[model samples]
Target: MSKKKLLVYGSIILSMLFWSFSFVWVKIVYLIYNPITTVLLRLIISSILLFIIGKGIKKLQPIKKKDRMQLLLLAFFEPFLYFMGESFGLQLVSSTLGAVIVSTIPLFSPIAAYIFYREKIGIMGLVGILISILGVSVIIFNKNLNLIASPTGIALMFLAVAAAVGYSVVLKNMAAKYNPITLISYQNLLGIALFLPWFFLFDFHDFIYAKPNIKVWIALLELAIFASSLAFILFTYGINHIGITKTNIFINAIPVFTAIFAYFVLDEILTFQKMAGIFIVICGLFLSQAKLNFFRK
Candidate 1:
């Protein structure tokens, strides 16, 4: 790969790692706060930090009046619905299962692209999607073939997946008009606006009375700085450099990274089945991008 390609790929991986760690961080935050409070505070802090950064660099360009609707839609799908689904979903299911389901975003993202942009998927890519699904199934099921997660939890995680696909599709178009920092900052602000009412309605008392310790505060800072802000900037940059389909393929790594993090931090078991599943998921990720001699002239 050239230097530019390497940078793009590196940024994608960094975004994946930041997002992977967020699974752990979310669990940590829930120790003291509810989902509404967690998501609200995350967006609030990230929006403020991004505002300060944008002002420091004098890159705070106002959104075009015509583009405001599209920006709102982006926020609606992402920090709004996406976090709502993922956070509440985590409460219902194991983080491992949630990560596995969210990793399927690449599968649906390409379909969304094809629906909206008429992009075509090659045979290899479809095969890769199937293999990755099998891998995720292995991770989620035991020898008895029973799913460890509830159906409601699975549905909520899929909601997150769908919202993520929408976010990526909209984000690709928006990148033409805005840089990554401005887009993320503005979308986060819009997300805060949308979540404020819900937060106050549901989590206001929880927020006021919750006694968060130093550890929870660190997790909140990590979410605002690394996961919410920097990860989003890197993800948006990747979507701009590559298309949504290619950018989303990296999501398969999230489950792998999250599993590892859980093993070390939460003392979750890294069983043989999960290890094999992680290996297969990695293989599927590479296969999804492989172009064989069948494409030669």
Candidate 2:
């Protein structure tokens, strides 16, 4: 692979890693903060940090008047609706389970991508997605093949998956026009605006009364800086370089990363089945990215 290809893959993988860590971080934040409060504060902090860094580096692009509505819609699908589902869902599910559910974004994103951009996945890509989803199923299901997670949590996480699919469709239209930093900075800013009323109405009092210690505060910061800010920026870069279908397929790796993190941080058990599933997930990721010409050769 060339340097550019390497960079795109690196950025996407790093974004997945950051997002996987987010599941763990949000769990820590939930020990004291409510979902609304956590997401609101996360957006606020990320927006501020992104703007400061973007401006200091002179990389922030001005939003064109024509694109304002599109950007707002993008933010609505993502940091607004997406966080609402993910934050609440994580409250009721294990971090690994939550990540696994969110990782299903690839399964749904292709339809949206094709409808919006005429982006089509080849045979290899389709097979890879199926294999990876099967791997995800292996990780989530018990030996009896029954899912034991909360139904509400599963539904909420699927809500996040839908929001993410919408976000990618909108993002595909915008990524070519904006740099990652500018896009994510504006995204978080708009997300904050969208979430503000809900925050005040539901979680304001809780936010005031919540006394988070150093550890919780640190986790919140990590969520804001790495997951909210940097992950979105990197993901935007991936979408700009590769189409949405390919970019989203990387999401399957989140479960693997989350499982490892959950084991260490949250003391979640990592069974042999989960490890085998992780290996399968990695194989599927590689298969999705492999060039068909190589297979023919």
Candidate 3:
């Protein structure tokens, strides 16, 4: 394989690993601090490290006005709305369920692309999307539970999914000018700057008063360093080289890893339905990406 292919594959694999474990880490952090405060703090740490390693801080060049606007939009769709919705959803639903639902982002992305960018939703892709959705629903709501009972949580998770889909579309459109690394890094930095006012107004007490145990602090640190910063770096690289539709497939691993984490850490038992749903979801995602659908387009 060519060097470009190697970079794409490596970036995708790292992105998958980072995201696979991130769901568990965020859930663990929420145990110590509330979602808003926890995510904000994580962002702060990530921004600081990124700034330091990015350069002496001054080495970062000034962003153009248009690109600054793009960065703000990226942050709005990603860290702002996506993380807000996800952290809130995790508070209400299990991490496994949140991971499963978020995995359906690829399904939603094509729909968004179709609507926003005049992209087509091929029959095979549609089939894959439907399969993934049903599988995720099954994984989330086994025979024992009703999906409707936690409508708020379900809605929040979908919002996160939608925000992610929106981010992908935005990135696809913006691919012409800005490098994905600049886009992702700027978004993170902008998100940190945006949260400053909120930090003083809302998270002040939580930041000062909250006493997170060692493990939760460690988890938060991992979230900032590995999951947030490193994952963004790798994902930006992969998304640029491989394209978003192709790169997103590895997100399929997230639900499975989350299930494993839930089983080991949360002591959650996996039901037959959960196992079955996982199959359905994987099938759906595969169908959604089937090459025949691309030909149909």
The TM-score values for the models, in the order shown, are 0.93, 0.89, 0.90
Ranking 1 against 3 by lDDT, winner: 1
The clash tally of candidate 2 reads: 0
RMSD (Cα, Å) for all candidates, in order, is 2.5, 3.4, 2.5
Model 2 C-alpha lDDT per residue in residues 1-297, reported as the tens digit of each score: 999999999999999999999999999999999998999899999999998999899999989999999999999999999998998898888898788778768766765766666665556656777887787677767889888677788789989989999998889889989999998999999999898999899999888888999999999999999999989989999989887768877887788889989999999998888788777766766666554432221
Ranking by TM-score: 1, 3, 2
- Judge candidate 2 at residue 97 and give its lDDT: 77
Tens-digit lDDT string for candidate 1 (1-297):
899999999999999999999988988999999998998888889999999999999877889999999999999998999998999999887666678788878777766776788776566767777887888778767789998667787788889988998998898889978988999999999999999999889999878999999999999999989999999999989988987878888888898889889888878787888788777766776676665422222
For candidate 2, which ten residues in a row score worst on lDDT? Answer: 288-297
**Highest TM-score against the true fold, candidate:** 1
lDDT of 3 by residue, 1-297 (tens): 998798788888887777878888988887768777877888888888877766663435556776767768889887888988898898888777788888888777777777777676778887888778788777666466666327788799999998999888877756656654455567787777766776788778876887889999899999998888888778877777777777888888878888888889777677787778887887888788765545223
User: Between 2 and 3, whose lDDT is larger?
Assistant: 2
- In terms of lDDT, model 1 sits at 0.86
Which residue runs of candidate 1 sit more than 4 Å off their true CA positions? 291-297
TM-score of 3: 0.90
Instruction: Name the lDDT value of residue 201 in candidate 3.
Output: 83
Residue 203 of model 3, lDDT score: 71
